[model samples]
Target chain A: MRGVVMYTAGDVRVEERDDPKIVEPTDAIVKLTATCICGSDLWPYRGIEPADHQVMGHEYVGVVEEVGSEVKNVKVGDFVVGSFVISDNTCEICQAGFQSKCVHAEFVAQTIGTQAEKARIPHADGTLVATPGQPEPELIPSLLAASDVLGTGWYAAVAADAGPGKTVAVVGDGAVGLMAVLAAKQLGAERIIAMSRHPERQKLARYYGATDIVEERGEEGVAKIKELTGGLGAHSVVEAVGTQESFMQAVGATRGGGHLGYVGVNYDVKIPGIELFFAGIHTLGGPAPVRRFLPDLIQLIWDRKIDPGKVFDLTLPLEQAPEGYKAMDERRATKVILTF
Target chain B: MRGVVMYTAGDVRVEERDDPKIVEPTDAIVKLTATCICGSDLWPYRGIEPADHQVMGHEYVGVVEEVGSEVKNVKVGDFVVGSFVISDNTCEICQAGFQSKCVHAEFVAQTIGTQAEKARIPHADGTLVATPGQPEPELIPSLLAASDVLGTGWYAAVAADAGPGKTVAVVGDGAVGLMAVLAAKQLGAERIIAMSRHPERQKLARYYGATDIVEERGEEGVAKIKELTGGLGAHSVVEAVGTQESFMQAVGATRGGGHLGYVGVNYDVKIPGIELFFAGIHTLGGPAPVRRFLPDLIQLIWDRKIDPGKVFDLTLPLEQAPEGYKAMDERRATKVILTF
Candidate 1:
């Protein structure tokens, strides 16, 4: 088996590694059909987050090759999608729709990298959801998307309460931000604004149901959103970019008593209490509980109601994982799907 | 008219000041029946907030003496309880139930000090909620409580979603925190945990429906809450102390997907983004949209359904305003009511 590993910052390698086997009675061995590099991957790759011989990739979709004795929900020879964070799913937290904080939760990226031929999935019954049937080859990309990015964007929109009669503004042009535009639209938002400076990304944003596009960043971006919403800012604002400036801009772009859902894993950012105090908005965010929305999102994708696969502008073979990382890190690709 | 004025950190004096006059078409002149010292008033009294012979107090229950042409909801001779912040109520923000952030909002404490014999309330129709009729002597303190502390606490409980089947933890021993306990109980919370070290406050907390009292502070307090909640933390947490520790404690005490409502006016506090991000909870806070809850609060007080006035442990005449301030500043009184 071959897997992607990073020995140091800015260094990615795809080399032969031990084939993963079922480690727990509830675990299943999955032969990954497809996986991808994430914007979060850039954090470690760009040295913003540490990468010391770390396994790479959390987003994946695959066929179950083998299952342990305790795995009931999913069995061998079934196509499935799983959340980035493994959970028991039956815990009080997961039952409350916060599977990401499941009592037995584990970050799959740090333990079982999916950018490989095969990987062991713990708590398989709770973490993996099988499609209605084995999805067609054409539906693979969108199914893989339900693993993280799309699910994260959906969580952001839901957390922001983006629905009918509301204006939603997404602050980030990344894959997650673009997917948030689609989520807000699907949730019946009356208007969607995508904040992006790049012409290409802006075009993609429009394709994802963004009714307006603002190129400005920070204060100017917030002002633009406020101006478009009759000086009240948007009714719902999504923060998908994990930066100090982007976080504050998202906060400022929400109307008073509005909802601000931030999904960006901000690092080293200190939220000024005074500003947030005066803003007086409702806020909810974190590593999204993707498992909560997977079943529905998979249905939308399977029904072809949404074309989320278009987010993958670049694709590469599994062995070329390094180039995929480089392409995404250099901003030459919005998202790069890796083939098996 | 005589009013309470703060000449410096420890210097308070009742001095004769010009009588308030209606300035805006939306203004109304009210003869104050009662006023009280607030926890926030201590900020300037302690010099944490600057005060230069500044008029003090924002809470009031009074008789309307005069009204400008546009004041329709409130009229002369009407007994009223008004919010600390003046709002036009009909504005988009106010209509959204965030009157504290109304576009034309102004802090009454900063502009029109109710500690005076009379106050010129701006946006009278919006800020002042006329009681059903003239209140009996006993209901005066409770009606005044609705002006800020009681209303603020109610907003906190509402914001935190303290309702049936939820565990609510209040992280402050102030009047507002105690009121939050009462509000949580009224909201049908399954359990109410009031964090307090003072024995007297604990007794008051029990009277307000706190099922459990935790004497611990900081990490110990959070630990006690988690232990009581089966290691998952509370479903709703209210932060009524405006300090970095209290803010973080409230965040720590909320379970993933839980709600945190904060109302303490923090002077120098910075929220650590990483901690808040990973906490994955919902938070809403600020000066509180007291006007949004004033009517219901007034009704609750009117019907004697809630005894919020019990929070005022001391009383002083208008000329003894200096002693009232000193008592609160010295922690000798939970709250001090001023009479004519």
Candidate 2:
């Protein structure tokens, strides 16, 4: 089988690799139907993180080709979408809505990359949520979106406590951030602010129900948000960028007693304690427990309640995985979907 | 009127000052029955925080000698206890339960200097909670505790989400920390851990319902908490010390998806971003809006449901204010109460 591999930072290639097999009794072999490059993939691609002969990609919607005897929830020929992090959802932590930190969690595609033709999914019964039926080919991209970005964005909005009567601010214009706007809208936030400088991203943000857009960045961005919120800042803020500046902006953009839901994969950043304390913001975020929201997101997508697939501006064949990585890394595309 | 003033770091004096008078339509003049030195006062006394010719103390229980025409809720001759920060509890922020950040808030001791024979309280109707009736002289100390430390500790416990079936850990052993242990117990936390090295503080903590004591400091303290909680850390953590190390320890000792309520006045501390992001903790803390909880706390104190007055181990006449500050600064007393 052919798979995407990075021998070193900025050195990605599609190479022949061993076909993954059911290694654990709870594992399932997924025949890749669709997958995409996540914004987090840029971490290793930009030399910001360690990457040495590593498999790539963790977002996928696929058909189960084979399943171990212990896998009861899924079976061969079923279409399914699973979270980036595989979790045994029955654990105490998972039941408490922290599936990402489940004791038995394992990162899929770390070695047997999801970008490949086939991959082994551990804890299949708990990790994979099947589509109601065989989803239409047109719905594939949207279902794949629910596999990571949409689910992550929904989690961010929920964590930020965005709901009716809330004025929500989303920091970052990436796919996840834009999707968070959609999620906040779905959650009934009265006002939504999207902080973005990109005109294209801004348009999408508005379409996703952003009530306002702030073109400024950094302190100026926070100032604009405060100005729009009657000088109290937003009641809820979603941080979708992982850098120090964006994190601070998100923190600063929230009013006292507000909530900040952060989803950006933090890199090298130190949040000043005094500033955070003084801000008096309630915060909760991390690698989102996507598995917890997958079922609902899939239903919303299926009912056409949301169109998260619009984030995929470009698409390609599985063989062109490298180009997908390059396009997202260089900011030429919001996201890329690879169809097998 | 005589008030406690800090001429410089480590130098406190009781000196005659101009008597307070009604300065605003919402103001009231109170003859202090008692005022106490706080753990935060030691910050300036130890030179960790700068001190010039600043008036000292923020906690007080007193009799209302005069009320402005606009002060409707509180009347002259009413015995009351007021929060460290005076707030016009009618503001939107105050209505939302964040009275400390009310638009018309003034720090009591800092703005009006509560450690005086007579002090002016702004927004008297909203800032002060009157006791059931004029209290016996002996109840003054406990009522004074309700004004700040006790109410602040109760807020911390509530903010930390401590309750039945939860394990709570306290990361400071000052008067506020000991009081937090009591609050956590009153909130029905199943297991309460107090992290303290001082034997005296530990004894108070145990008496206040600390089920476990961790004498270790820093990383070891966190390790000890983990060891007691089956390696998952506490369900809730109350951080009453504002130092960077204590804040980090509180963060580290809380389980994933746990709550951390911090009440210590932060001075200078930088929190690493990745640690906070990955820890998956719900954090909420600051100068507690004691006004939000004063009515209930005063009721608890009045009913003999809790004895928070034990936190004050030293009492001195108003003329011995300097000695009261020194004793608390040197850790010779958990707290010092000065009588006029």
Per-residue lDDT of candidate 1, residues A1-340 (tens digit): 9999998999999998899987799999999999999898888898988999999889999999999998999989999999999999999999999999888889999989999988899999989999999889999999999999999999999999999999999999999999999999999999999999999999999999999999999999998998999999999999998788999999999999999998875678889898898899999998899999998999999899998888999999999999999898888999999998
Per-model interface RMSD values are 1.2, 1.7
Model 2, B190-266: lDDT tens digits are 99999998988899999999999999878999999989988878989999888889988999998877899998646
The TM-score values for the models, in the order shown, are 0.99, 0.98
lDDT tens readout by residue for model 2, A89-128: 9977788888987778777756557988888999999999
Q: Model 1 over residues B147-264: C-alpha lDDT tens digits?
A: 9999999999999999999999999989999999999999999999999999999999999999999989899999999999999999999999989999999999999999999997
Model 1 misplacement above 4 A: none
For candidate 1, the per-residue lDDT at A214 reads: 95
How does the DockQ of candidate 1 come out? 0.78
**What are the lDDT scores of the predictions, listed in order?**
0.93, 0.89
DockQ, every prediction: 0.78, 0.64
